[model samples]
Target: MNFETVAPNAVPEGAPLIDVREQNEWDAGHAATAQHLPASTLMENLDQLPETDDPLYIVCRSGGRSFQVAQWLNGNGFEAINVAGGMDMWFESGLPIVSDGEGEAYVL
Candidate 1:
């Protein structure tokens, strides 16, 4: 699978930053602008992915899940980018994480 590393600020304005982590981890912290769509739900929700030309940035607490999701997207013809550091890397970089809001939904 094709994969590129995307730094925290590299995300485009108004782009969908997909968080592929579990619910509890997401509740603890995540990119403020990221949308929760765990890896397990990715294939089932391919229709919701952003346009093919735009980035479908996938992230996880660490890097494992995002890699899987990235591979899946790439295999399916989407340009998938992996947030190399994921949430842990983001936190280590001193970036901020937002609380889960009403619009947030967790994957099983």
Candidate 2:
């Protein structure tokens, strides 16, 4: 099945953004409004995904993982869009990022 992709800056504001990075990476930093859903356990956490017809934007450190996740999700009947360049581009684009820790947000 075909999958969609969008650049970090192209992701719509308030859209459902899912970060598929690992726990340590997520803890380091992530998009302020993104939901954490590590790719490793994505299958087990299917129920945690947002329930909506709207497109789900998937992101990771550099887009590879997110692309894979997006493909799987799309094949499984989800409207998943991979975030091209992922969090790295998001950080470089000056998008808002927050850390689960107390330190300033910086992509891991």
Predicted model with the maximum lDDT = 2
Give candidate 1's whole-model lDDT: 0.75
lDDT of each: 0.75, 0.94
TM-score quality measure for candidate 2: 0.97
Which pairs of residues collide in candidate 2?
A: none
List per-candidate RMSD values in Å. Answer: 4.2, 0.8
For candidate 1, the per-residue lDDT at 55 reads: 70
TM-score between model 1 and native: 0.80
Which stretches of model 1 miss by more than 4 angstroms?
A: 101-108
Q: Each model's TM-score?
A: 0.80, 0.97
| Candidate 1 structure quality by residue, lDDT tens digits, 1-101 | 45787876676767778898877778767877888887777678777766656878888977778978887788877888888867877777777677665
Report the poorest 10 consecutive residues by lDDT, candidate 1.
Answer: 99-108
